[model samples]
Target: MKKLFILSLLVLASCSPKELTEQERWEKHAENTEIIRDDFGVPHIYGKTDADAVFGLLYAQAEDDFNRVERNYIWAIGRLAEVEGEKSLYSDLRARLYMTEDEAKENFEKSPEWLQKLCVAFADGLNYYLETHPEVKPKLITHFEPWMTMYFSEGSIGGDIERVSTRKIKDFYEPNNQLAVSQGLIRTSDNEPRGSNGFAIAGSKTKSGNAMLLINPHTSFFFRGEVHMVSEEGLNAYGAVTWGQFFVYQGFNEKTGWMHTSTGTDIIDEFEETIVKDGSKTSYKYGDEIRPMDSIEVSLKYKSGDDFKEKSFMTYRTHHGPITHANGDKWVTTALMWSPVKALEQSFTRTKKSNHKEFYEMMDIRTNSSNNTVYADADGTIAYYHGNFIPKRDVAFDYTKPVDGSNPKTDWQGLHALEDNILVLNPPNGWIQNCNSTPFTSALEYSPKKEEYPAYMHSFPENYRGIHAIPLLTEATDLTLDSLIDLAYDPYLPGAEVLITGLLEAAKVAPVETNVAKEAIELLKKWDFKVSESSVGMTLAQFYINTYYRSGKIPNMVGNKRISRLGRFEYMSKTASPTERLAIFQQSLEQLKEDFGSWKTAWGEFNRYQRNDGEIEQDFDDAKPSIPVGMASSSWGALASFGTRFGKDTKRQYGTSGNSFVAVVEFGDKVKAKSMLAGGQSGDVNSPHFSDQSQRYADKQFKDVAFYREDVLKRAKSTYHPGEKNK
Candidate 1:
């Protein structure tokens, strides 16, 4: 009997599939890749092929900040609830609603051979990092899979998935499943708008007769890492890459530079579905037929003390998409673009394109749904694409509200062609700028005409930054790299100009009786509208705006006015009551005096930049060392935005976002550029790179980029393979 059992075991063992171990595959990949660290700690990865280059890029990213890399994947996949608790379960469900693990695997299997190889390399690179560093333990996801890449294909800070409200999902999927009351559609002002600034200057506007591009992304500090990726197969791109992503999200190659700004295009819409119930069966009305709704069971695990517990939910979906919540009597489903395979292909292939024609060919894929592209190349061409992946719809129905899903007319009619998009090619104005504003104002007189396109194409309003950039770019000629950098960091705040003029006029008509208020108004009247570390006027103006926003004075003055920050400022200047304006200003003075014992505090005393540790969510300390930043927020129309918010248990407002990774590139005979990061490259507190760039960031100083092989070698600080340790 023992001999027979042994024979059966041996047969089972031999019949199992055999393959190389993860370490063995990693060693093979490492042989084809090399990583070089420059003086500023930027990784310049060289590989024999594109897949090999991605392998080195991910490995280098892990070396810099493995915590962020792991955290990004944990949140991207539907596993955040397992680590964070029950409150995050709705967020996990939102991710699962768009794509399931099985669907992701199917997408991976259907990809082309070349892309499949890159996905394999992406997984292998992170798995190898774990094998090499046993000390770093992940919160979840012990083993990375190639299919997991599908969840995070396009590298926007927060993709379209974030637009779906988690609270709505929670209200719909809870145990009671009670219907929520309908709140009238209201577009509230975002506390800190998450957007970017992109500018493309043609050769006709430059001193060197070369097209120049500015890539400034105002994101959460340290959200992305600076990387330089190279391959023997004609792939060399340098820019900021979101952590855990394989592509350089916003960057440029030697021949061309590309910058992406968040667009105002209406790509995602909500549909009102008429749900039908027959006993236990559920159906949704689509056109003339009633189709059965798709139902799936989702099981989620959450941490309770030291043990793990699980919960199960039955989620419903329709042809439009998932039923997230109920609107009045109808179930509302969200519809957005979700093409993981094509998006990944377009993202990776765009890095290899060298000229305008090639870049245009890549745009034909139309998988990028959330951003606008500003392009400049060595061929002396400059172009602007308002939005990629626009879906064609009937002009009669309003897309901003929930459309009837039962109506066949509500269905999307294929995608709009590239020629049909809002595009500007070689504008006579010699420059293009988009600050997440309407493309109709991208170029002064050379901007695209809104009358020619359908109403659903765009609905973005003019912002303070766009108003600030038009005059600067229109008059800009004989521009050099230094002048462009200076222009980008210009300290003047146009939003402040409008509000201060109102305050001065109000003080003249209804002068405040308090001495402090009189002194504050006098100081503001003599100001130049420029922000600096020592500028007391900026400090006073920021407090004044904060007080007005919190005091609800503007709404009282204008009768429930809901508008953009700039629009609010314009109303305050031209229409607001003088008594209300004086009262708001007096409140700002009183609050400032109470907080700091004086209303004459400098901007530097309250606004600062600090990073004390390597934690993903940093804690700021008033007692710790911090650098004073001179820039203000984009809400105030400062192009070099340094936005801030109050920290925990502290009086000083510490900066947590804005001006993260900034670069200026000139596509001349050779690609000459200068770039700066908010902090250094590494996330470890003990590493020298943790806070090396903090002073440079505060001073608005930039370092020259090492693009050529000779330049990189000359500035190389360390070089190694994937498995090697730095000495």
Candidate 2:
């Protein structure tokens, strides 16, 4: 009997489950998570917990374009120079100047328990992906760390950190070659405008009597991926996620939606410090005392002729901020938002908010430094927050220029309360829009008064995109999701209207030369300023505008304030001589003929969409098959912005940026939304989804978003766990 009992006890011991190891725990989490790839290759991640959802989210992101996922982290964590060589050393230095690996880890350690779990899931997801797919190769980051998320907290592409000039950082730290750092970085009209257009309409203006929101972000192609993440912990959000980020940057839930536009509000400022150098110690002058400047040593590695080389720099900082560069004889400290933990918290918590009040409280976190938020809810509320991280600076100093660090009054006096910032909540016009323009013109007459706010609070001038959106929104009534898409993708170029009238006046007075120039002028004369696939006028107008802006003769300012691209267009149209206009038109004609065989080539023939491979910096070939894109650049106020690029060997320009991820959402009892990506979801050339949406994108055809569980299951193309072979 004892022998039989011993044998039975041994059998019971073998049947009992053993405790899981850390890796096994991760595997269990993966098992608990499910990712459903919809027809469009957008991942809909469902998990038992929020952390599990995040884990599956990252794994799915890696499956789509691991190159971008790894690349973002490599760049974010100050390791790009290790792969890209000496050119990126300053970029690495700039990253290190703000936060070190230890600092990031410390920040992660200090975060709330829930946030830490999310961070852990972020790392585990990417690391598990690498483990499961041994065939995949990472450029630099083979093992992602939880702390690494600290460096890339907010979702705006590159965020405010990118605004800091790496060129200036190099000039200050590199071997002695003195050059004065310019106080103002005047962004000219020639550079492709890297801002987004956001619109929110109240139920009063919508057909379904539900608030409508347009999530139109003008970014570089493939900059962000469209995704839907859901968890049992009341987390269900659909939107675009910047590569490697765990949270959705732009998108909506059943009850609320949010869109972010790059804000021109002066969130970043510079302080000129009076340096007092003595022996090995350095001090800087402040108010009534000399304060010691903090010096930190940073060493960066760069690829050098198949080998790695190291460079060390002794970076300095003051109470104002890190010394980014030198201006004249003064060391300049750049002050911007740097609350990584709070920023990430706000970014994630924002996705879970169900109502405007919850979202409003979330905004109080105030770490969204570089974006202006356009928000809407199911309750028919439409609101706009111009800038969240506005610092309360004394009105006596011009914050636009570098101010004296010695003056205590010049320092930022904490952040402005939410009410103090430029805010529009349910304007009387029933519509709100911000296209990186002045908040004063956001909602027509209903916009916040400019005179009421401090100059630093809303310094941006009215842009072409803002001018284009206002009238359309003003006249809008009973807007449906489809009609909202139509309004967002409006082909009429208001910017072209401002410039073409001047060209017509010039043609009347200027000396007539070639018949080609006469034909171009006549095409401009009778035509409405609307862009289309077959519009030869659009081709000619775009070419003329590009040529004029490239000419560098556009006035930089009117009165004292710096002008925008639209302002530059207005300046050139009114001020340029008839001969100058005619000459520029001739130049445009000659250039057009040189590129496209004839100057009469249609806009679509010249502007194209092509994705030959999955490379981040795509190579353009004129011989390669490409889709015709009817859209024009935002620089010309074409709201359906499509910025294109040309190669040295190619004639036709291929799209590279603008309107990358677009979605129109209507919030009712259940969310109804339609979205379009620039190309498709997968970055692998072999995947069926690589260029699946390219044609649809050119046609401005958006697909329905499967937001509900039943809807997701209906359209699901493939479903699997994170490490499962079926994926």
In order of listing, the candidates' clash counts read 0, 0
Residues 615-679 of candidate 1 have per-residue lDDT tens digits of: 76667789898989999999888898887777678778887777899999999779999999998
lDDT agreement with native, every candidate:
0.87, 0.89
Per-model TM against the reference = 0.95, 0.95
What lDDT does candidate 1 reach at residue 299? 82
lDDT by residue (tens digit), candidate 2, 552-670: 88878778967766677776688899899989989999999998889989988988999999887788888889999999899888898888778658878788889899999999988
Instruction: Please list all clashing residue pairs in model 1, or write none if there are none.
Output: none
10 residues in a row with least lDDT, candidate 1: 181-190
TM-score of candidate 2 on Cα atoms, chains taken together: 0.95
